[model samples]
Target chain A: MEPLTVPGMLPALEEIGRYVMAAAAEAGLDKRASYRLRLAVDEIATNIVVYGYQPSGTEGDIIVSSTIDDHVLKIALEDTGPEFDPRQHAMPDEDELTRPLEDRQMGGLGVYLAFEGVDDFHYERVDGRNRNIFVVNRPSAAPAT
Target chain B: MDVNIRSIDDITVVAIEGALDAATAPIAQQQLLPLATAGCRILLDLTGVPYMSSAGLRMLLSTYRQLSGKDGRIVLVGVAEEIQDTMSVTGFINFFTLRATPEEGIAALKG
Candidate 1:
């Protein structure tokens, strides 16, 4: 599918999600995989709008593209915002995961969930742009139990 | 996203429809968080919610914390399959009671 380029705004998230979900379904992803694919895209796209563009007071565009190769669907989000690598963020530690609800912090779980739902996540800075790539492997030919 | 608020007996049910992403989460927080002050039994009906990101999960956690502080209870009803898996994987599943339907959730919270 052709890549989609949209302004880095909160409302643009749903557009990106729709495109990704369609691509995932076309690639023969199951319901579980399809849901995670859209969610991971939502997480990254949101960061671009909120952290990357919003804070800088500069307008930017988020370019989303998808491809399916060998039953693996890869979605890449390239943004014109600052250089941010989501893969570098620390995963929630044992304490963060095990802490009681009251003591638990409110943030950080988005990044964690973004990574958790995908088989692999990649990040890179190219030409002064932030590119975050997420990969989801299609279910095997074998039927799900 | 559209939030439909209703009350069944003493339980407050918030039914959210649409994707609960960053843009829409604040709307939910604004309407649902205030209910925490009442510290009454709450049921989050996600049947209409087709998708949820981490922002949605955080909202649920914060709401759970608020209710827990007041010794009140919150249950999630009609949770989408994907949302349920996300909660289970994030360990958020243990924090609140989840039921397959609104009736079940209300029964659990009221019991």
Candidate 2:
């Protein structure tokens, strides 16, 4: 089922995370698996708050959900804030992942991190909204970096 | 949102207990900034903190930058596994000296 809004940590992200994570956990999702999905949710939701609000002239909300019937936890974040297809960004190069701690140059790693955390990721811009859907299957429960 | 205060040698310690995300991060950042600037050494005890978002990460990064310039440091103590994992995956585990316990923050200051 869907939890509360996970938008921008705007007084609701953690609450959203708790609810979704609880659902995932109750569905037999492990702590590592649950944390990975929720963290990815937080990261993507924050991205919507930051980028979705700019360059798009629209604003939207973050939606998180877990489904036992589907044997999957699908986190779909929708924001009318901007037309961002996370598919555009390349995965971060692990060899170059380590950078100066304060270097803002590597700020784009959030999406890469989220991508790594999930089983499958897709980004779509439909009907004037940017939708990012990340799917995690139960069997492949490893929390990849 | 609750804050507990403790003194460990030369550093003033503040243990933040609660959510450090977009909503609460600003509050925590504001509360820590003035004290971190006015003091010589500071330690943020994150023992009871369940979660911290990138907004919180930004505040910590900003604080580290500020403290580093003044010959002061922000030591993190009792970081949870999830927090530690997040920091490491983001390549931030070694950015600052991390202690396993709050008392170690004082010890780091002493050394």
Best by lDDT: 1
Instruction: State the TM-score of candidate 1 restricted to chain B.
Output: 0.94
Q: After superposition, how far is residue A76 of candidate 2 from its true place, in Å?
A: 1.9
Any runs in candidate 1 off by more than 4 Å, and if so which?
A140-145
Measured with DockQ on alpha carbons, how good is candidate 1? 0.75
**The best candidate in terms of TM-score:** 1
Give the Cα-based TM-score of candidate 1 against the true structure.
0.93
Clashes per candidate, residues 3 or more apart or on different chains:
0, 1
Task: Give each model's whole-structure lDDT.
Answer: 0.84, 0.71
Q: Model 2, range B1-111, lDDT digits (tens) per residue?
A: 667777756788989998776667788888788776644788889998987766677778778767766766678898888888878887777687899997777788777
TM-score of each: 0.93, 0.83
Residue B84 C-alpha lDDT in model 1? 85
User: Where does model 2 exceed 4 Å of error?
Assistant: A2-9, A54-59, A69-71, A89-96, A104-106, A139-145, B4-6
